[model samples]
Target: MSEGNGPTEGQDKVQSSAPPNAVWPLRDKEGNVTVPFAYGTIAFWQGKRAQEYQTHKWHVYVRGANNEDLTPLIERVIFQLHPSFNNPTRVIDTAPFHVCELGWGEFEITIRIFFHDGPEQGLEIKHMLKLFPRVGEPSQKKPVVSERHDEFVFNAPNEGLLQRIGMCNTRMPNGGPAWATIEPFFSPLNEHEELLRIQAAQRRVQAEITLVKEELENEEQILSFLQDEVKKLEPSIVKKPPGT
Candidate 1:
């Protein structure tokens, strides 16, 4: 009843001989002209014989009685005959029984049944068929910056920084009284680098402004000196003084 599970029980086996009022033709291993049987629902052969029903492979089919239609009862029979209904790998396919050949008085119905290995094998077969399509396909690549850098340093606040600085000092050479005398230039080197850039930019701007102001002052001083000389020369060039 569940998916992929075959019949559970009550599957009747084909008989060796034919039943009453049934007719069936017998064929050789190659399906050549053989013999015909009368009055039998099922037929059988001695030793090993090859019979093909549904699958390409040939199997032996033994005849049985029960002249009634076997198609309707097939489901019940398979369910009874198969091992377990819960097996994960088993799959069954069934078809309506049909009359292959007509005999004297008896009739025979041919049933086709098939069983598949499992889903995994079927999937593997499919993948094998698709290998050429998957070949030469490009794989995804990740950016270099996606990975974290181990050398990147993280700095803490003043109190924590001082603690770490003190710890480093304890391991220094001639560490006793030198600590008080030597100024601990906690060169927040990392911080200092940033501060250095900011200070450099500020100094450049200030220098530019100072140069512009000095140029303007120099120009004003030169203009005043020129005006004073021009005024003193104007009196000398004028016509006779008061004594004249």
Candidate 2:
């Protein structure tokens, strides 16, 4: 990731076919790039878990153009949650940039995103928290209403990070794309999907074990019948041994 302060507005604009302005593009697997934009969402709502005291809920999610969740690329996300909660300003440095926090009331949340690889290309965004919907408002399905799409620019990004950001950057250090470092942070790593996968795997294993047990029982029954028949044939042979 690039290491520096946020880029100015003028640094991000491109007026001609060739990028002439100051903005330098990070390399993806494709090639040397000029300006790259990623999708970002900032949203907030009332508590889903239902706390005795009213608390607001919020999250910031980043993703690639293909709609792949990129929340994991974030190295540290500083959230200005609210004034009421203990340590209202929280800094989360981990995978899953979509932060979950509680506050006593509703307010605007200012978020600062720091990328694990591109520290210099840090981004600042805002989201307004809504506790209650308007009266007679049509029921909406999405949880968070305040969402946005933002284009972020990186100037002179390090070779390592270039491979990770663009549509393509193949010459990464580990023989993988540069984005490999941040790949683990994708929001798909969230607990819900992971739990489902584990449950499904466990079910498959149980079914296999049960089937094997039933097959073993059938084999045992067959073996027992064969043994009894052999004993009866031995008795018959003994009775006829004198003349036959």
Candidate 3:
């Protein structure tokens, strides 16, 4: 459902400083800025039949988790599409980072994230483009969405970046808090949903393990009974004379 990236070191030079007590989500005591983001593709079918070379209309995007605006931290988002299309390298320098296209096939998409501060190196991620429904699944009016959630950890960030992080007013759904108080980018409601999904998967796996163990035990018992029966019949089995 989601994936995470390793922590990256920010510029060591402090551009300025902020109040030590300012509250911000994903800001640890060590002044690290952890920004949660997601990237995926959403496709809509174009009628029941393929239109020339195009079968569907789709858009690929990168954005903050829970649709949070990432304009403050990210400088730009670069998407490298398949070479078959004209001008495969696309760049978006705004909050709505996306690219729209029409195609009938799937390929690997390479995304690069550039920061506002001086890291000099942009973070690179790879995502597989999906165009078809999964096996045994039916299609409907709803768009097919394939997404992955992840985080960008900037260790020892500079002060200008810190100020921007502090200025961001993260709102909780259903009007919980004016400011982001809890853990990372996700609201409490979303977090709870994700937790429940994980728990359900774990339960299913555990039940399967138990069933396999029981089946193995039954098989062992049957094999042991057969072996014992063979031992009992060994003496009674007719023996032919060597001369015969």
Candidate 4:
């Protein structure tokens, strides 16, 4: 009976204690899940965290041939965030600005402009990708295709926060391509306003100069007429003006 009780006691002890061979099946043997890569998604990871994680978002663009209105494509742009990356990825809202539904042949892609909020908050981008239709389907298999990654880098020396809001510079990561020139996001109205101000100032100065010259000419004419009248009156009064 003691021998029989010993096996029962060992079984009870094992049941009371935690199972030694218990494992979480969701994770791999190394505690990492395999993730496949694909196009139309920007892959990025946070550097500081110990837990390995990845993020992905769909890419959208507006195209044109030559310089024309390609905004139609932009209006129809779509946003699709991966389930794993949605929490960390930024989403764009497009309620503020008016979107025109006209397209040109030239190509221009719009992206969420990211800015550092503070030490605690990670970078935030105004998610504006919901306006268009989804373009390419996401791939599921391995050996992922390399999508055309259009990344912009800035080397600003004295740009303020306001100035940096819309400034963009296209550059390649990992020294693949040379840095391009900085570009601004000003509309046509801003440029037109500046030109109109300069032209109006020039016109005002020209009008002032013309008015002064006309006044001087009128004064000289009046003086000449008065001198002639005086000469004619002297001849009539003295009766010897013709001989003089």
How many residue pairs of model 3 clash at the backbone? 0
> Which whole-number lDDT from 0 to 100 does residue 210 have in model 3?
100
Candidate 1, residues 1-244, lDDT tens digits: the string is 1122222233233331212322322223553322111111111111123222211111111111212222221221111111222432322323112111111111112222321211111211000001011244322221001000011111221443333322221111221221111112111123345457768989999999999999999999999999999998997795877887
Per-residue lDDT tens digits for candidate 3, residues 1-244, read 1011111222222221111221355764786787666788876666667555566666677765655556777789999988877677888786556677777778889999888873779899998888777864426465576777666788887888766655444422221121111112222225466568768989999999999999999999999999999999999999999999
Alpha carbon lDDT at 119, candidate 3: 79
| Poorest lDDT segment (10 consecutive residues) of candidate 3 | 1-10
How accurate locally, in lDDT, is each candidate? 0.26, 0.47, 0.64, 0.27
lDDT of 2 by residue, 1-244 (tens): 1011211111222221111222233344545343322333322333355454533333334333223333434567787755665565768564334444443345677888777478665888776665455554323233434433334555666766664554232111221221332233223223355457668989999999999999999999999999999988986674546656
Better by lDDT, candidate 3 or 1: 3
Q: Arrange candidates by TM-score, highest first: which order?
A: 3, 2, 4, 1
TM-score of each: 0.20, 0.42, 0.60, 0.21
- In order of listing, the candidates' clash counts read 23, 15, 0, 15
Runs of candidate 2 exceeding 4 Å displacement: 1-52, 55-73, 117-121, 134-144, 166-244
TM-score of 1: 0.20
Give the poorly placed runs of model 4, Cα more than 4 Å off: 1-189, 237-244
